[model samples]
Every structure is written in C-alpha cells, then in structure tokens.
Target: MRRYLLCTVLFFTMISCVVNRTVVAKPILFDAEREQLTLEYMRDRYGLETSSSAIDPKMIVLHWTVIPTMEESYKAFYEAKLPNWRPDLENVSGLNVSSQFLIDQDGTIYQLLPETTMARHVIGLNHCAIGVENVGGGEGLPLTRKQLKSNVWLVKYLKEKYDIDYVIGHYEYTNFEGHELWLEKDSAYRTVKTDPGEHFMKKVRKATRKLEFKLVPEK
Candidate 1:
C-alpha cells in the first residue's frame, strides 16, 4: 500500500512540473488598432473574414530574432504598426510582425500574445500557426542549449493544450505553400526565411518524437 501511494505521488509531481513551467506574460501592443489590423490581415491576406483576431492553431512555427538582446526583441514587437525599417513587410500590411511567444537566451519564455491568436511571424501560415520567436540568432549570438530545451518544453506544452499537428522551423513555412493550411492570397508575397535553423528544429523534433507531429510537406 505504501509503494502504491508513493508511485501516485510521483506521478502527480511530474504532472505539476509540466503544468507549472515558468512562462512570463509580457504582452505586446495588441491594442484596438492591432486587433483591427489583425482582422484586416486575415481578411485581405488570407481571404478569411473573421470578426475576431483569434486563430485555430494547427502548427507551431519556431523563429529567431536576428536582434541581439531580449529588450530589443520585445521592443520590435511592441508597436502595432510595422517599423519603417521593415519596408518590405510594411508594403504588404500595416500590422507589425509579432509572435505568440519569445524565449530569451537564458531560456526564459515570454508570452507576447495568446497562443490561440494570429501572429505575423510566418508568411503563409499565420492564420493557423502559432509563432515562437527566440532572441539572438545572429552570427555572434547563436541559440543556446538552454533555449533548445525550453523550446522542446514549450512545444510539448502547446501540443498538449492544442491540436498541433506540425512543429516547423520558420524556414519550412514555404513547404506548406500548396497544402490546405496555406492561406496567403498573393502568390508573389512569399519571402525566403532561415530562422531557428534546421539543427535547432531537428533537436526540438527529436525531443518530442513521442508526440508524433506530422512531417513537413514536400517543397
């Protein structure tokens, strides 16, 4: 009887650790303007006429902020309007690029927006994909081992909560171009991406192999 009780307690403890992973809530400027812009983006870009900016996430797209520090990364996504520097993206939409989550180099996870909301990180799959941006991916600031572990944890946590089918790198977004999940209206709007590199993605996938995420479609 005592052995059984100990086993039960251990199981509950494991569950608690999984559920209580630290995720700091550092929400960006998802104000009224951002919400409206998000709705417009969905309608104009993806051809989905939804009143709310909420999304039904089918996949998680991982990214890396080329910017070096956590503060800079946060500031980049703080504004509702796209910055002038990002003229290429600004031409496409006024809605600034943002992600649902951002992980610092030290592996601190910040929730920039709700997981089930649309973020402009991925070009074609934003409507149904959750974005996770990691700080510092430049030549000098490669992603750390801690970030990789945190990403794996985040992926598992999100997968458990949502019906997520695929965990893809930002670069892999284009592979789903012709799949039903692809929703961009303009064929010429695609951009080449190589954030949160293939090595990082392979680690995340191997760590969560038991989740059985679907492989990325052939490009």
Candidate 2:
C-alpha cells in the first residue's frame, strides 16, 4: 500500500511540472501604467466600453513597425498617450498603436504589453486579438531568420496560455470579414495596411503549425 501511494504521488508531481512548463506566464514587459492607460484609450478612442470580464483574447496578430531599431519602436509604443505624426489616424491618437510583443531584427523578443489587455494595433479586432510587432521592415533593416524563430516561440507560448484560434498577419485581419469579432465603430477605420508582409507571415505560420495553431486565411 505504501509503494502504491508513493507511485501516485510521483505521477501527480510529474503532471504538475508539465502543467507549469506549458503555461504561459505573463511577459515581463507588462507595465501597470501602460496597461491601465491602454484600457482607458480603448474605451475612449475606440469606444470599446470593455468591462473587467470583456477582454477575452482569441487571436494573435503580427505586425512590423518599419522603424530601424527595437528601442525606438518600444519608446513609440510605451507612451501613455498617442503621437501626432499619424494625425490622419482616426482613433484618437497614434499612441493607440501598440502590441503585446515586439520581435527585433536580431531575433530578440520584447514584451511590450500583457496578453490579457487590449492593444490598439488592429482596428475592429483589438478587443479579441493580441498584437505582436516586429522591428525593422525598411530597406536597411529587413526581417531576418532570427526574428522568424522568435515569432514561432512567442506564438507557441501565447497559444498555450489562451484559447487562441488564429495566428494572423496584420494584413490578413480583413479576411475575417463577417466574423463577429471583426467589429469597429468607423467604416473608414478599415484602411489598407500591409506590415510584416506575406513572406514573413508564411514563415511564422509554417513554424507555428508544428505546434498545431491554425493559420489565418490569406486574403
């Protein structure tokens, strides 16, 4: 009887370890100030009107900043408010641009926000998607292999934590079409956006497929 009890305890201990390892912990970059302000911006700028229980994420969207460095991109996204450069951006402030994660050209992953909070990266889908921004997409700083690998790791991590159904590129967000989650207040808000292009998203999807995530349909 003692030997049987010992075996049962060992089995449970192994199961606990597996659960712990698979669970995605909140990324370290989550700033309380930024999180609170982001939620407020979502309410005021996008008119999302979310309650504490409303922010259940269902997809992960990938993007590129077009900026040269990760630090610059981080600074741009870290501000509590929006910027004026994108004055044409109808959503209150350009500061509404944010993602939960940022992957650098060299392949370093920077967690800019937590997975549970809403980031203003994608219009219509911000309430149900987690955005991941990749640094550098211009001629001088192209996306690299390292960034691709890091994206795979990050996608897998998020899938393990949330009930994530789709892993999509920013450009493909429109493909959701009639899905209930594709909602935004302004019709003009659905402007054309192509970032972290098709090639990059294809790589991310192929890598993440090994982990069993469904790829967002190509538009």
lDDT of all predictions, in order shown? Answer: 0.92, 0.73
Once model 2 is optimally superposed onto the true structure by TM-score, how far is the C-alpha of residue 90 displaced, in angstroms? 4.8
How well is each residue in 1-113 modelled by candidate 1, as lDDT tens digits? 99999999999997786678899999998889999999999999999988999999999999999989999999999999999889988778999999999999999999999
Q: Among all windows of ten consecutive residues in candidate 1, which has the lowest summed lDDT?
A: 14-23
- Predict model 2's lDDT versus the native: 0.73
TM-score result, candidate 2: 0.76
Clashes of each: 0, 1
- Encode model 2's per-residue lDDT on 108-189: one tens digit a residue: 7776566776777887788889888889874677788887877877788788888999888888888876676776655655
For candidate 2, give the lDDT of residue 70. 75
